[model samples]
Target: MNVEVIIVLVALVGMLAALIMDKMRPGMILFSVVVLFLCTGILSPKEMLEGFSNKGMITVAMLFLVSEGIRQSGALTQVIKKLLPQEKTSVFKAQIRMLPSIAFISAFLNNTPVVVIFAPIIKRWASSVKLPATYFLIPLSYVTILGGICTLIGTSTNLVVHSMIQEAGLKGFSMFELGKVGVFIAIAGIIYLFLFSSKLLPSDRPETSGNEEEEQNSTLHLVEAVIGPRFPGINKRVGDFNFKRHYGAEIKELRRSGHTYTDLGNIRFREGDTLVVLTDDSFIRTWGESSVFLMLANGKDYEPAGKKKRWFALILLLIMIIGATIGELPAIQRLLPEGIKLDMFFFVSITTVIMAWTKIFPPQKYTKYISWDILITIACAFAISKAMENSGVADLLASYIIGLSHSHGPYVLLAAMFIITNIFTELITNNAAAALSFPLALSISQQLGVSPMPFFVVICMAASASFSTPIGYQTNLIVQGIGNYKFTDFVRIGLPLNIITFLISVFVIPQIWSF
Candidate 1:
């Protein structure tokens, strides 16, 4: 390898270590590493910044607003209420009643908000019915993830991969193209959950299920608080911050990057650190809207979407999906010029503006809903991937893989791609994992002298099937906090599902998108 290739390889390793170690945010780490590569003359500024303006990245931003409108409109709430069993009996029966609807809803909406809205409600419902909240919360997150993989817009990761495909000068994914394999994966995941979750998942809540009376009487609550720009404790050590005096909350654990820290004394406060606090309900009422904190989990009530507005939001969502899917048909696509054809980006942009104009979600507060860190990570990923290509790192790696797996056929290469992407997703964000893997996947296809379709599909499945750990996906993190689960809890429940997805995806993707 050349000096530049070696440097890029070393930088890649360090980036992974930092992300897994939780020393800094993934975006920050990735951006910093790419900058170093740029400084060494490996990547041009244009290539580095291309991802920032990518249709995929912008689509994710627009979808955040769209999801917010649906969330604030209370449309999903009505649907969920109808779907949940009125009287829950056993964990298995409740799951049978609840998980499918959750998956269906999540397939359309963003998974994070779906979990955010459902976790507490399911907890409360499980409590009222005298069943364990733990049984339902993790499955709720998993099903949403499964559902997300079913459509092009189901998760930001799919969109990012599609964007990469387009950037490579290939025809991008149709709206439901991924659903060919994704729907099957979702069905398989649901089956796995129904068969094994009751036995493997925790049967009791760490605390009393979301009972108001019990919550009111309890001396402490495990609440999550996001540090806002206005937080005064920034740059101060946790021990010196006097959190109890300023916010009336005591920190029990701190989650940054993907690592959880309990050693508050030595850690410095930073914006975006999710502090798991031990506080009472009163703390929520008192500081719920304070500028010092961006968001307080389980604190504020979501205003139900007004009657007329709720229907409007749901209709707008359907229009985006249906219009985009129909627009991609050969007949309709032929009508429009290739340069400006109707696509998911077009539909999503129009839907967002209409929703904003109608005030489905407050337009002024739209930026808060976007996950800026994820966007930054994705944008930087494009640069890093470009660096890998330019510096010969991707080619070098592809040569080794081809040498080792040539005897086993392209299936081995596809399996390797899936395994690497899934491991990266577990360590970092799904979008970032997809970004990093795409160039290498393309290189492998070129090396093997076959179609790249199966490789592309593998990246989508592997990057999004992050079921082995809470840090693998954001939805997992949200559910972990709400369910009060330990690390092993995920391993016990998720490993089998991961294996099932692996088998299904590896076996099915090649058949449909043949090499």
Candidate 2:
């Protein structure tokens, strides 16, 4: 009924509308909501800016730099190569066996890089072993999501939620807290995948029953075409390209930033279109030298120049994680003194600087690895959470939920928070979702007069349980295009997985932590 309450409600509705309609990008939508509410006197200017300076925000930014160091080190490449099943194993069996390795690697390294390394390898393996690449594609995405839930730094969403909780004056979660439940979910999903995965997964790859079959579908030629500014191809229809005569290439797919032009006939080919072709090494070399394609002229194969010390990078990464974990415990934290403490930022910064010293990325290029857009997005999310709290809208929403939850007890409240966070993760980036829900979680805990830790855990899990849609997680979008999957394929596989996560969270959370 109050004007401030009405303003907050209007802002909330606008944010949801923007997410649903895919209007301005997610961070922009949330930033607009915060600015508009602040200018209207719903939230104080200080509240609007509080999120930008939070320790959580800084930690997430630094961890991105750490992720970059690991990526540039060439450590993961060797591990990934070893993960592919050897020649004697059946393709289906190989995928099932590799699930644990895939999930565990994703737990430590960034999932995006893991998939980039594995996609083409799996495609080639599927051909050699006579199996469909599709079987492994969905499982790859699922395992990555499961793995991200296991650690504090596994996903940006976890860091975002951790930051919001600290901003609200609560302790953030431990590294392995979610692992207790997340590992269990992963095991169950992996078992289900192994049992029914081969059947549920489609067989789209070229099936080879014998030598005759091999020759019939003999490997496609690799073609690389450069976009000449004055060429007729620029701004012309893709179907109009004289591929058969001029290039002798079939356009498998075209990537333009985040979008894909899979069905080439309907797409208009523009300059700088990076086409994924299936050609030979000689042609690929020629194309690469001529600037026909920006990258990947050597086909989807790894030809490293030198041997790698995979163990060194792996040990360093583990040391950083272990150091950060031990530093967070009460017993050890007490001895260090007031000024000294281990947060994501400190550990990540130390690790990145050390890695640079070791020439992982040559400190100069380290700046290139950071994703500035994501950092900006995180800072803005903090501002939005503060706006909601000051507007008193979060309080009103919290009270209504509390009254409803009295009958069902804290379990209902925990589940509700988790589901709401998951919905937000699906609708917007995970950082924005965690930001938008922080005030509500804090408000709910206050109304119930309980520790806010359980609610914080809820946000952590929900933000990472983003497997239902491609838009929900960046990893999903990467795999969807690589595998040539339909939208409905994701919906069918992901819906059941989401429901399973929901059910597990509802049952296991209250038992593990106080509600």
Stretches off by above 4 angstroms in model 2 are: 205-298, 303-309, 403-406
Give, for candidate 1, the lowest lDDT window spanning 10 residues.
205-214
- lDDT value, residue 229 of candidate 2: 23
TM-score of each: 0.89, 0.83
Per-residue lDDT over 168-250 for candidate 1, one digit per residue giving the tens place of the 0 to 100 score: 88988888899999999999999999998879987764442234543776777677776654678788899887999987777
lDDT of 2 by residue, 1-515 (tens): 68888887887887888877756556677778878877888667787777677676677666666665565566666666677776767655786667888888777766766765566677677667766778887788788778878887777777788777766666777887777777777777777677766666555633111243325566645433334223356666778777545555566667553355567886776444546555444555444322233223233565442345345556778888888888888888888878888855668778877777877555775554555556777877877777677768789988888787776777888888888888988877787788777788888888778877777777877877777777777667656655656666667777777777888877877677776
Root-mean-square deviation (CA) per prediction: 3.9, 5.9
Candidate topping TM-score: 1
What is candidate 1's CA lDDT for residue 109?
Answer: 86
Each candidate structure's count of clashing pairs: 1, 4
